[model samples]
Target: MIGGVTAVAANGPAVNVSSVNVTPTDPTVGETVTVEVTISNQEGSNSIVDVSSIMLRTTSEHYERVEDVGAIAPGGSLTIPITTSFDSAGEKNLLAHVSAASQSNGSRTSHLRAYYRPITIDVEAPEIDAGIAASTNNSGETTVTLTNYGNVELTDAEIRTAVDGTQRDQRSTFDITPNESESVTFDTTNYDSDAVTLTGAYTARGERHEVTRTVDLNRQVQGEIRLTSVEVTERGTAISVDGEAANIGGTDVDSVLVRIPDSETVSPASGAGEFFVGSVDASEFATFELSSSVSNGTDTLPIELTYLVDNERITTTQTIDLSTASPVSPESSQDRPAATAGGDGSAGSSGLPLIPLIVGLLVVVGGSGLLYRLWNRE
Candidate 1:
């Protein structure tokens, strides 16, 4: 009886509620919905019914009313629409009614009403899910990626990284759609920690959520510089050494130099003592030459190297054998005559055959003696 319709006057026009329709058969919380109600005057009515007001109400106290709905004749019907929204998620009960009046026996009859059956609406709650990940590169750069894995979009996303007691935050604002991702980067060159911690926050469905992740940083071991293929050559009083300086470590080195320091057995050659090698990257090499004056009977040479690694100075010393060094010889001239005696006792300075010259001198002397004896006989 509480939800049933009761007419005050039975002889009045038979106006009754017929049906109710709700837009969006399934609804979510915070979404607007429209309810359409139909009213009809029964075919056997005696007079036309004047519909004054249409009212709708829900169990949650949401109400709507429309007035001045005009009139409906016998065997006719009319429909009215009302709009409202739900705040919470659940199945709600709604009631609709119509207020009408009609003329009977030359007098006006008001307050005649009819009610519709209870309406049920179901609503759903919002859902949110997200995640975060981080990684570090060899150059000390850290990148953080954020993923939105749920049905809602994430807004005002931010990320922070902490390492070696130092913390850094992203400065830009960003958003990620459902099933999408975004990334941010930070420079960790000055930090000395082997690992980094990442923290992030974002807004989804008007609620704030936070996430944390930790990742190990890429760290390179301390490397060394080595000398390979060393060769020594002695030219007059000067000794020169040639070799390749190689970086045999995992990191690059700067300001590399190779020199022959002052010593009793070996002294730096004039103007060419030390060799300057600028930079050598990892698994790379550069050729260098060092000049020095090695004393007589000295069988060993000391070579020194100095360079910078990670802004720190490093020095190393090595010794090379001088006995194995080969001496450099000058090329001979082709235009000069030999200084020694040749075969047949020929003088090397004149460059003429001795046998032929001696034969010619003996013939001239014998001819001159014969001519003189014949002239004396005459």
Candidate 2:
């Protein structure tokens, strides 16, 4: 009897890829990440499967690949790890693929492909934020501060300073970490400008950023000379004035001179025209004397002061009330003494009367002569 032959179908290897995971699911640009893909063999498979290749890829590009993976038993799973770095930042989809072959009769057959579920990865962009501030002190020293406010560290930081529009020779360069600050100081004593500008630049995440800050400089006079303790004394036809010059400003003054300018009512007194009080320091004083001849009907003494401040000449005028100095009247209470009553009940000057004293002198001389003649006759 001829029996009908029944053909048996062969069972191929089957693999199910699931659970696509990425270490550091939230990643920044240019940061490395690891992708783990779990590959499982179906329980109904007839033979052990050998994984040929495992690849981690996106929809448009492949990031990592590994070949020659070992065999996985039926109803068992194997995990494949791949490492890569993302060059850009944004939402990304990652898919993993596994190639497997069935091992039967000690031989491997054609590969079967399995794809893992795509995973969503959020890639963050690099953050860079910074600022700059500047300030100056009374001594003409300026300080600049650079602050990093973002997550990235700053590198190759440089600071440049300028007074008005003129750039300075001194430059500062350093590094600053995230959420930190750095400072630089410069001597701007020689620069007397009104404004100081600070420019700063730094590198973060392969990009350079620049910042600028401007500060107003307090332009104060280096030396301020003020007249103090002034006194006016009258000596015959000459008037002598003594005073102190106080320097109340920031620096010292040079070639300080006090003089009474020649005017209709006042003129310099001979050799004592100008008094020199040189080099008065800040918050210090120097004594000076000025002499002048004052005419009648003068009410104020116009005193002129000249000095050198920061190599520049400065002149100032001050006035002292002559009415308060000495009386202008001839019979002033301070100039003449009080009168007294004489023996004849008449008001006389301080001493005896001039004519009466002269007559008494003559009478005494005649008496002395008469006495001498009588002695000679005897």
Candidate 3:
């Protein structure tokens, strides 16, 4: 209705949202899902400006924006992809809009916006119940895996706190898509308390997100190394001890280092220098230096010993059973006397033997009657 036949123009380009589709509408809370907005040259005119403005309105769901289509001329189209993550499971309404604005010659400013009917989407966020297979790992280092059967994709997944859920420290992070699975490392050094929590969420694109989860990271009280049957006999001058490191827990022991409680001198101060434990690749299994000897009498008298699986240093002390070859000489049985002594006969003995008795005994023998008579006769 510009001027009948003289037909004038309107403000901005006449555009329309060709299609509005949101994926994973039923996304799991704490997980990420995608939503696509496809616009087009509905009018097939030369009025479309840059996609200057895109609007979205929602209550319990949020999204990340990813804009790509550089410019759209007349009769051209554009597609914008955005990611949304829900905090909880519920229904949501989105008032999403995209507007095109253009500046004509002289001094004219025009604006046009395409509106998608107020769209409704169902949000289902991710829920991961993570837990530990063991309460403690003897190796000191350990691993944690997560399973997600929720409706959303877990993204920006990471640990929220350090020791006892304090501050996020040297922990790890990962993403688990819908019905996907992932895991991370739980260092036993900084945090010893089993009171811990895992945090992560579904991520898409627009803004940084925050998530927290309560997992069943219970320390396995038993996945311990129990020497059920130790054949501690003798293997030549060296001892060959063999046993199994059982997983008395529910989950698998991913990576760890097995170690034995050692008496320093038992093995000569390894002239081989500190046995480099070469990188422990597995999260729950590793092979460190084997025992070199029983007791360093001379050279390393071989002793066949296997350590109680050590997960680096994250697990509880692996209850071990060590059997060294019956040392050539049993450890000295005689108590060499205590380190403290007083005049009382029952006091500990830390000093040398009484010398007076020795001297007196010699003099008495020299003074024997027979010896004295012989000396006088001579």
Candidate 4:
């Protein structure tokens, strides 16, 4: 004791351990953590502390270290940061040790200062799988499936669809658990056998992931046929209908039969109301004729047509008016109506025979007048 003052020991290490900071103290498996070690020589009276090495040791399953840190001057501090990850879960211990040489009270000695920290790790991982369902077609209904394949739960799962490489529809589910799957449907009628894509998107553990699936779409064949330019004619009591039938669809039509269906005001002049026109190719036209005995005045004719497409008999009906046509008399004999030689021969005509009927009416009136005058004179 000098000057009657009791000697006081230095409160901190000559090379002081200032702080030990751990980043991401709460970690997940497969994630990184950072440990920062700060050391200082607080006393200028001591020589510069020669730091040989700095090592980071953890009680966790993995081990990592940092070495070859040369030295630190007196009254100066050094900070070292170490980065590492954990493979297992649970609590872990970390130690940062600095090996140094310094002069204390004029004597050279080796000193070690260590800092400690603890970490807790939680492990959670999420996986996703997506695909298009089998046999998805152009019937306007297509299915898409999304599966959660990992150990964690996912949220806000959405599935979107693309037809023929263009985005078309989307659907969503609120959440999905581990190893769980969900499905959604979309209308795909506007798409053909090109390509259909299904994309599944979701979030897990604050991170987002997505998966995609693609498949081919199969479409069905459709056919359309139409009849145009309908004309009706009459000869005596016989009636005939004429029109052009065309196949305007994607498929061919065969064994086509055209006819005027029988109604209360009309009956077939020959056998039945039907007449066959054979086959009509795609985008081609054929002429049809139907003969019947129809009463005068405005009459509705039900013209029914049928054909074979893919071994299916398809029938269609067309309605027409026969009021505009004039009936020709067989005995009154004007220019004769055109005769169509069917299995039963039938005829067609145009324009009325008005001149001969008017002449006959005049002659009858004049002969009546002459007879009347002679009887009066007698």
Cα RMSD for candidates in order: 14.1, 16.6, 21.4, 17.4
Backbone collisions counted per model: 0, 0, 49, 0
Q: What's the lDDT for residue 103 in model 1?
A: 57
116-162 per-residue lDDT for model 2 (tens digits): 55666788786788888877776577778899887667899988888
Q: Which tens-of-lDDT digit does each residue in 1-378 have in candidate 1? A: 123453334555677777778876765576567988787888988888888887777555647889888788889999988887788988777777577887566455655655455677776665677788877665667778888887566899988877755675564447987679889888877766767777778997678897777777665644467888999998866788999999987788899988889988788987789988989998899999889997888888888889888778999988888887888864446656655446655456677666687899999999999999999999
Give Cα-based local distance difference scores for all models: 0.77, 0.78, 0.48, 0.67
Candidate 2: residue pairs that collide: none
Task: Give the better candidate number (3 or 4) by lDDT.
Answer: 4
TM-score on alpha carbons, each prediction? 0.39, 0.41, 0.31, 0.38
Show where candidate 3 strays beyond 4 Å.
1-12, 21-24, 30-34, 58-71, 82-88, 102-108, 111-114, 130-147, 151-175, 181-378
By descending lDDT, how would the candidates be arranged? 2, 1, 4, 3
Q: Which candidate would rank higher by TM-score, 2 or 3?
A: 2
Q: Which stretches of candidate 2 lie over 4 Å from their true place?
A: 1-131, 137-221, 327-378
Residue 93 lDDT in candidate 4: 55
Worst 10 residues of 1 by lDDT: 1-10
Cα lDDT tens digits, model 3, 169-260, are: 44445766656666666555446565555554334333444455444445544233232343333333333334443444443443333343
